[model samples]
Target: MNHPLYGYSLCAALALMLFFGIYFLTARTPDKPIFSNYLRSRRIMGVALLVLAANYLVHLLCELRFSHPDQAIFLNLSTYYLSAWLFSSALTSLLDRNYLCRNRFLRHILGWLLFTGVSAVVLLLMPAGIPQFIGLLIMAIWFFVYAFRLARRLVRTYRKAVRIVDDFHSDHIAAYIRWLSIFTYWAVVYGVGCGVLTFLPKRYVFLWVLSSIPFYIYLFCSYMNYLLFYEQVERILESEMECKPDTNLPDSEDTAPIGHLTIPPKLTLWLNGHGFTQPGLTIEELAEELGTNRTYLADYIKTTYHTSFREWITMLRLEYAKSMLVKHPEQTVSWISEASGFLSQSHFTRIFTEKESCTPARWRKLKD
Candidate 1:
């Protein structure tokens, strides 16, 4: 692969592996309810990514050949609308909760409609040929807007899931939120660059090379850092949770309020029991399983564990995911995420990076 194109191909490969990893894991497990829905969404998104990759590759390959540039390029440009449509579908899947069994006809129409709307806006404002460089810039802007909006929704959903008084994991929940924030900022920066590139002359277009290199380098370094420090810890923690003593309870402050001291033995059993089976259990549902009220549970979590229930569940999930990744190397991170309890591959990616400080791909690579 050519050097410049190779960089993107690497991303494409990573995305592809991520898709299948989730698929294999989901197929093998066949029981994670929460993750089942996410699996459907991710499959949709993954196909879209493949579409985007193919479109980009076609354009790049045609450009390098410099033969029938106009015709080849025109063919490539046609895919842009399709690529954008796919991208919109992918984003919509990410934003939606419980996408499995969703109305396929509705989804297809939504994606196509979104693509048409965006294309119409672009057409009305710009001339033909549209400058490949400038077009990329516009697309980046679209990406950033969607990324930030999605981040906000995730944060809100997570917070809503947390309880104030229960024993919960803080690090894992915080990590999820932080990762989303970082990605949001990343999107903003990419958008800013796109805006900047709009005015640059053709000769100075190579400046994009200089700008993008640093961003990619940062992403690579972040991946490395996450694998070394956090990924290892999360794996260990997950294993402990999976096999956690069903009867033995972690010590909490006895002097703690009724909410705090209310740690039910049945809940421990429930946690361990489900640890063996359930995929994608939420804190609210978990609280219900324990026969506790959500608000009281929140107070118990806040007073006894000094964290929210959401955080605690995330910690449990991460701990389990990490263990699965290490114990079942053949299994993809997506499988572990489903088995451990996450909403989607995007959610899993954000949390894993936040908690483990590395992408699942980087973590697996390190173990290899």
Candidate 2:
């Protein structure tokens, strides 16, 4: 608080955290029943953010109250350590509640308390320089360890989320998380910088703390963009609910399941009729076209085809593209990609290279 810049920064952080806390708490949760857990997560996360803001507020207050504010260093570091753990939980909640379930949250609280208790003895009782140095070293180590651990969890959870979307959808859910990758990379940098600043003077720490205002702003924006993907997830859930199987009688499709994902007669006919050559061929759309339901179609594709609905559709598109390449030598690859149901030539080429181990242009040349 002695420094005007530091005072302004703390006030700014307080406001940012307050805004984020309220947004997460009051934001409209997904209306779909399947997302109840996610809604619960948001509420818990909002509380965590508010707690973090309180940490900043305490710092500001202590700096103002005590002529020798360093007398309150223990209080400052203790609350920050507490807020640090909660902050990780808050971000994890944004990803998935399961990552920090009740058992996990309790375990984290216990560990934080145990560590804080032991460190308090050092900070409060030990001689001057020893306490500051050792306390900081301990806090820095803990912060780095947990921050790295949470970063890994974020990446893993994000990848799984993308996979889940692709498992059932052929939409552009991949786009939702593309910018999220930028945020993840920035988070790693922020963690490293903050951990280092833990050892530095308060001035440098305040400067870095100020960085969090924009960091979180960018992060929240990217996260909100993910709601578009959630909408698709809600649709899938709705389809599952509406198309739930009946126990009254066995499903005729279940009785005589196709072997090895043999294209069912109807799908075979549809394929022959070039139904797979249309862009945005989601499983729900395919099910509707087949006069079936989404759940049954998803199960059929997953169990028999040994691939996700997204990959299955992509494979079909590539096959169609290959044939088109062979027959229409003059047509551009871009034209073939769009004609064969891909979003773009680049997307088509990427998938082709991944699946075929050659570029579409090279493949066409070899075929010619």
Candidate 3:
């Protein structure tokens, strides 16, 4: 191996693995179910990153053992093991966030066994360069199929979450899932490129290998940035949860019948009378204040406003925000965002733009 580029690539992979490992260790445990999934997905991705680094290390060892026939055989076996392990780890991390799957653990285990078995068989049977192409082809097919399924499930999940809360919690989780799906899709594409390059002429193979190093390094950095963004969103969620008071209610309320409860007109009066302007206000809190079960209140909002509790609250906030913008043009967007019960300016801006077909600034300017 005359390629100095290989050494630099290996070093870069190792460095990224170390950084992600530290981040995985330091990341706080999530308090909510959505964030719990996020943390779990990140943990799995970290394991995948470590496996990738190990594969690179094994490749380095294989290169060093070229002169020693006996050692080369052993290193070659190690390379095969690491390669199969890397593929399995990557697939697991990519699919672990598919919350819509039932019996996920069993499915994941079966997938791991099947893929690993296929990879090992191909590596053992085919000529060295040929197996990579076949393996990557299989990987690419599986990734696209799985990613499509995951994307569909994520859309359904997001719709449900939107009905539950209009806040960033659901949106954050959906964004995380979308990013993971895209990452998996691109990862397979990269693997396919690497496999294709393996069939190139021996002289060109060196260049192919050299080029792959920076791509892997770039992937590692991108994932690290994604994790950092995920962590920041988690912190925002934690603060939002902390600010809201816990309402002790029966677990059965989740499935309780809300058809019998009479929703007083006072409920609307209370919401519009500056009650909806409280930051981080949740359905349960509003239900408690209304002296009704949370399910009943949710149903009431759904029936009366033809929207979910979250949507109703969001609408109220938007109306309040519009009035504030018209009356107090001097207030900054950030100030108005908070004053209108939004958790962050970004969230406010996103919703406002979606509803108004323009950004908050543009909408305000038009209204003025």
Candidate 4:
């Protein structure tokens, strides 16, 4: 093969296929109802990986055989088909969360698939130069625009979902979506570059194939990262559901009489009594401690406090840290962070800055 890395590329494709095949087969049965979207997304990713692998294998075989003109045409058609299929799968997975009404979401997915199918057919019938390039350019532009919009929506959905589940953080989900958007943008750029390369001399074709190898490696790695991330999120959700709240407590020495507070008296008592300052405190755990279900507790926090459980907890921790800084001016930020029940000083500083409009150190300095 003219492409020096052809064999290595095929091997990588095979490895990707094997890995996703195993993942698809061995994906754990979701223990909770909320993981349905997660499972569905994983299945979609598996299918996309499978198609991508097959596309690479076919390209390798075509190059090795020095395919006939008719075979080359068929290969071009197959490439468009597989690329469109994979793109559709990726977009569908991004929108698969319960963010939209089920009927509306399904309709949108169906429409996308139908449009991609038709575009692939049209591209297959078009001649192999300017016409194909135009079709690819249009599709690439559409994908980039749609992926950008979907990424934003996914971030919002992640934030709303995290409000009810303590272990779920919007950071990971946002990062994943951000990476996916970046990958999609680069994929379109590469597709356009390759289309332009086709118009050049035959010798430049090898360079095009070489450039594509990196993208294939990136795609493989990204898919693997996504799979691992899905598993991690699922594990956290399951553990959160199964964990029992820490209920053993010593009797209060001086019960602070509850004044007329809009917040639930029990919840307020728990917060002032230092329950909110406990490390790794989840809404579910707090709910169990207060003799309520997770949903009711989440609703109570949202409706009564006009904030999510996470923000409310952070508020409590921030107040505690402020008091500590005032009382113990000798304490380091790390010590204060630990004492305030934050996971790390960096996290503590980030929350403090977001809420206080200054870094922890600056806040402390101003206080002094």
Tell me the tens digit of each residue's lDDT in model 3 across 1-368. Answer: 56565556556656766676567646675475545655665565566556556655765666643344233333333343344333334434333344425576467557656655565555445565766656656754654465445445544543443333444321223454354445445655655566466556544545544554565555556555665455544453454445445455344654434432445765767856888888766666776777776556666666667865566778889989998998999999999999988888999999999999998889889988
Cα RMSD, model 1: 13.9
**lDDT per model vs. reference:** 0.50, 0.70, 0.58, 0.60
From the highest TM-score down, the ranking of the candidates is 2, 3, 4, 1
Whichever of 2 and 4 has more lDDT, that candidate is 2
lDDT of 3 at 314: 80
Candidate 4, residues 82-189, lDDT tens digits: the string is: 454445445445434433366755765575666566566545567778777677677656654564554455545445334324433312233444455566667667
- Per-residue CA lDDT of model 1 for 37-117, tens digit only, reads 334543554564455446445544554324343343334334434543443343333333432245855664575467545
Candidate 3 CA-lDDT value: 0.58
> Where does model 1 exceed 4 Å of error?
1-38, 64-96, 99-151, 158-178, 204-295, 299-368
lDDT order of candidates, best first?
2, 4, 3, 1
Candidate 4, run of 10 with poorest lDDT? 253-262
Query: Mind giving the per-residue lDDT tens digits that candidate 2 earns over 175-233?
Result: 66566557667867876776566567656657866988998787567557666565555
Q: Where's the lowest-lDDT run of ten residues in candidate 1?
A: 161-170
Q: Candidate 1, after superposition: displacement of residue 108 in Å?
A: 7.8
- TM-score each candidate: 0.41, 0.69, 0.62, 0.59
* Top-TM-score candidate index: 2
Candidate 3: clashing pairs of residues: none
Instruction: For candidate 1, report its TM-score.
Output: 0.41
